[model samples]
Target: MKDINYSEVNGYLFPNLKGREEVKVNSYFAQMKLKYLKTNEQGHLFSLMAKNELSTYLEQVEKEANEMYERLVEEFKVKWNVTEKLKERDQMEWVQQMNNIDNVVKEIILKELICN
Candidate 1:
């Protein structure tokens, strides 16, 4: 185990750990996954923490999920005929269709990437 230095602040001692802010993830998918892990996947979460890999793993998850999201959006757009032509043909209909696609894609991401 590595040494943990401490500093006195406000009549309390806190471990002086560097780069702790990296654990504060920004991606919505990543944050959801972290919460899920904390509540339902403690063993895996502990394993990552033991190796000091939680931040790195979450970052990777965010990147992969984002990439998958973009790819899936393109595929769904093609499958649903949500093209520029549709947008030009019927603006209201296109907007509705895109809103539906966005909701469905978010659900897919939550199930496949964030939760699982």
Candidate 2:
């Protein structure tokens, strides 16, 4: 498979999936395949490039998921700081939220990076 480039923005990047902010990214790649990857003049999409590009796009999606998870952790910390001083119960809730985020990020990162 051909390698595709990944772009990052604001320390966050989304995958070039069918939907999401990367719609333009996906469309641009589709057009690239239609123009350059097609075997004929019929503007048909090229399977190889499409597959490679989609995989690269998915990598971006995974990156975004991880970043979102980190953001959630930060949010949880801020919320916990505010509530912890008032109620001890808030600390347990904060820990639970952190654990959840950690599990999600681990699964996604492993799938995107190590397993691949």
Candidate 3:
């Protein structure tokens, strides 16, 4: 028997098989389809699925981020007795603080939701 190169097989197959249980189960047919399917068609299908999944995830993140930002702003307002009639420097400081907090929250969200 010939020595099978696991790395080669993984490099060739993983992209096609990743997140696809049916293809993993029917690997022989999957290999056949890879031969028959045009490369552009396969790429297009992968791109479409990726875009759909990413958009759905982004929508959820946007909703969550918006809610969190609103809550944070409300809390800050109540905690600091902030009003719409604040002085210019105070308003700028508040905006800067909110932006800093937002950056931290966004990092956490991306790490938790997208990197995991």
In lDDT terms, which candidate is top?
A: 1
Model 2: colliding residue pairs: 15-60, 15-61
Segments in model 2 whose C-alpha atoms lie over 4 Å from true places: 1-51, 82-94, 100-116
- Which lDDT value does model 1 have at 109? 90
Q: State the weakest 10-residue window (summed lDDT) of model 3.
A: 21-30
Better model by lDDT, 2 or 3? 2
Q: Return the TM-score for each candidate structure.
A: 0.75, 0.32, 0.36
Candidate 2 per-residue lDDT, tens place, 33-112, comes to: 33332345322223433444544544555456557557756665675553555346677776676676566655654455
lDDT of 3 at 53: 51
The candidate with the higher TM-score, 2 or 3, is 3
Question: Which candidate do you rate higher for TM-score, 1 or 2?
Answer: 1
Error of 1 at 29 (Å): 0.9
Task: List candidate 3 segments past 4 Å from native.
Answer: 1-51, 88-116
lDDT at residue 69 of model 3 (Cα atoms): 55
lDDT per residue as tens, model 1, 5-76: 999999999987555334767878889889999999999998887667898999999998889889988999
Clashes of 2: 2
Q: Give the clashing residue pairs of candidate 1, or none.
A: none
Candidate 1 wrongly placed segments (more than 4 Å): 1-22
What are the RMSD figures for all models against the true structure?
5.2, 17.4, 15.0
